[model samples]
Target: MESIYIQTPLGIAKIEGDKQGIATLSLVEDVALSNEIPSCLQEAVSQLNEYFSGERNAFDLHLNPQGTDFQKKVWKSLEEIPFGKTRTYLEQAKILGDVKAIRAVAAANGKNPLWIVLPCHRVIGSDGSLTGYAGGLWRKKWLLEHENPMRQQSLF
Candidate 1:
């Protein structure tokens, strides 16, 4: 798999994938991946920039994130979450047809390698508070605020 790191207002992010699709996008404190940016990565970088700039609401990149079957199921569920909307882990578990698997569902969410593209940041605690996120709670909060800004919140 090929990888390239890009700088964003949130922080430096490491994007890794190949012709098949983008697999991961992890926030990093530094750009340590010393490699040429591939054409696929350029598209991702542009979309990510548009996302951060609030000019784009949805991503159009082909993604082939790596993970176990269960994790893939969870990530796919996450994709169904509408932009600017949030869902609880329990709700996601219920959608997966097993309310008892809440913990496992949350675990899969935590293990989601694709980050924003997979929309794991859209999941929240049952009480509507931000919860676990591999990219850090601050980034999660920022993303939520970015997606659902104060004006948007007021509409509801």
Candidate 2:
């Protein structure tokens, strides 16, 4: 698999993929930025840069995240969430046709591998609270705020 590390507003982003598609896109504590991006990952990197710059609201890259069928289904559904919009875990479960699967849905969301592209960050708690995120709650908050068209105000 080919890989590349790029600087993002939040931190360094570690992107791994191959001809099949981008498999994993996650944040790493530290890593030197990649000087040369592989051809297979160039488009993904460009899209990500656009996303971070707010020029792009949706991703259109071929994704190949590895997971169980159920997980893939959940991730695909996550893509249905519109940019700058939020969905509660219960709402996501209902969208999947099984409100009782709320916990499972949230678990799958927590395991999402595509990061901002898949938009697991768009999912929140029933009470509109930011809950679980593999990239850390702070990053989650940052992502949600970034995607929000209404600028987030800073409190001193």
Candidate 3:
């Protein structure tokens, strides 16, 4: 697997992948950014840069996140979430066809390997609050706001 570290608004992002596709794109704590980006990860890096800059709202790269079958299902559902929308854990569980699986669905979401590409940040608490993001609630808030910047209303 090839890996490259790049600086992002949230922090240092460590991306790893190979010909099989990108397996992981995770946030790391205080790592020196690398000048060289692996060929396999170049597209991902570029797309991520565009995403942070608000030039792109969707990703068009092959992903190969590693996780259990249930987790993969949950992650796939997360990808279906719109760029500027949010889904509650209960809603996600309902989509999975088992509202009783809310806790399990949240657990799977917590384990999502791909961050922005899979858009785990779009999931929020049932009460419309930010909660349970592996990258921290602050980062989650930043990501959501970045994706959907609030527009100022005219006071005419």
Candidate 4:
């Protein structure tokens, strides 16, 4: 698999993938941006840039996240969550047809390898709270706000 590092508003992002598809993308600390982006990762780099800039609300790059069958199922379901929307872990479990699997669904989300592409940040706690996130709660909060920024109210 090919890999590249790029600077993002949040931090440095490490992306790994190949001609087949993008396998992983994650945030890392203290890493230099890649000097050159190979052809295989060019589209991903472009899409990621657009996403951070708010010009794009959805990802269109090929993805090949590595995971087990159950995890794959969970990830696929995550994709159904539209941009600018959030789902609680309990809601996700219910969507998966097993309301009792909230923790398991959250675990799978924690293990999601494709980062923003998988939209794991869209999941929250049942009480409208931000919960466990591999990228840290602050990053998760930033992403949630980024997707649906509140509009200012004006009074004349």
Instruction: Write one digit per residue (lDDT tens) for candidate 2, span 1-156.
Output: 999999999899999999999999998976688899999999999999999888999999999999999999999999999988999999999989999999999999989988898999999998988998888899999988888889958897
- Full-model lDDT, candidate 1: 0.87
lDDT (Cα, tens digit) per residue for candidate 1, span 45-142: 88998998999878999999878888899999998998889999999999999999999999999888887888999999999888989888998988
Given candidate 4, what's the lDDT at residue 52?
A: 93
1-156: candidate 3 lDDT, tens digit per residue = 999999899999999999889999999987788989889999999999999888999999899999889999999998899999999999999999999999999899889899899998999998999999999999999889887857455699
- Model-by-model lDDT, in order? 0.87, 0.92, 0.92, 0.93
Give the residue spans of candidate 3 off by over 4 A. 152-156
Q: What residue runs in model 4 are displaced by over 4 Å at the alpha carbon? A: 153-156
Q: Which 10-residue window of candidate 4 scores lowest in summed lDDT?
A: 147-156
Worst 10-residue stretch by lDDT in candidate 1?
147-156
| Poorest lDDT segment (10 consecutive residues) of candidate 3 | 145-154
lDDT of 3: 0.92
Tell me the TM-score of model 2. 0.94
* lDDT for position 83 in model 3: 91
Ranking by lDDT: 4, 2, 3, 1
Off by over 4 Å in 2: 152-156
- Measured with C-alpha atoms, the lDDT of residue 34 in candidate 2 is 89
